[model samples]
Target: MSSFEPKIVTFLCNWCSYGAADLAGVSRFQYPPNMRVIRVPCSGRISPKMILAALRKGADGVWISGCHPGDCHYIEGNYYARRKFTLLKEMLEFNGIEPGRLHFSWISSAEGVKFAEVANKVIDEVRQLGPAKVFIKESPEESAA
Candidate 1:
């Protein structure tokens, strides 16, 4: 439907992407209000289960942003995230989920504009796909009501 607005779950690295997001807000950059952000110490700390959990919990899309290559405060954390993300993408495909519903980016703390741009891009791509069908799990609270 033309009125569809997808819900996105976002994971951002504390030292980089999160800072960029904060800066984006401070700079008055306007982007779609579709994301629910979860800040982590490093993108490398994000487990595949967490992404899957987000999907299962009714997130229409998921985005992960981290430090640029060679700039992880934790040293090599972003590299680890990059490698894990590659494998995770394949896994999502194997499970019948469109990998396009998932997005990833490398962003520096100083890149506020870039953060807004990527946020808009991710939202547009997910909106085009409409709502996700698979991987949605009803929680106990939902079942109770």
Candidate 2:
């Protein structure tokens, strides 16, 4: 069998986490290439449906990152995001999704090192969890076959 490499779907807030990721790239910080980033205007813009969709589409792991608490560009956006993430996490776990398959963090634009570190940590955790099998939405033909 071929080696397994988990596919991580990362939702990053444009004002902070995305900038930190960009900084990490520009600074040449080493990190795994397992993440597929989706930049959002703010963390609060990420809905539960978006995360669930990623999982259903076969993401082995999902990560959502934003500015530090009280540091959102939209003032209270991160606060809202934090609440949403907590509830979403609980709901997913209740429905049998592995806890290690989802993650959340706060990373500022100046924290490129932290960004890289978190990226490694997330990748390692997902690798330990192995490939995602739950909640994947196979095509109708595949399902029929």
Alpha-carbon RMSD of each model: 3.3, 4.0
- Residue pair clashes in candidate 1: none
Residue 40 of candidate 2: its Cα lDDT? Answer: 99
Q: Any runs in candidate 1 off by more than 4 Å, and if so which?
A: 136-145
Ten-residue stretch with the least lDDT total in model 1: 134-143
User: TM-score of every model?
Assistant: 0.92, 0.91
Candidate 2: lDDT over CA atoms?
0.91
User: Highest TM-score among the candidates is held by which one?
Assistant: 1
User: Mind sharing the TM-score for model 2?
Assistant: 0.91
Residue-pair clashes, model 2: 0
In candidate 1, what are the lDDT values of residues 1-145, reduced to their tens digit?
7899999999999999999999999999999999999999999999887887799888999999999999899999888988988998998889889989989999999999999999999999999999999755566765677
lDDT of 1: 0.92
> 1-145 in candidate 2: lDDT tens per residue?
1478899999999999999999999999999999999999999999877888789888999999999998999999989988998998898889888989989999999999999999999999999888887765556755576
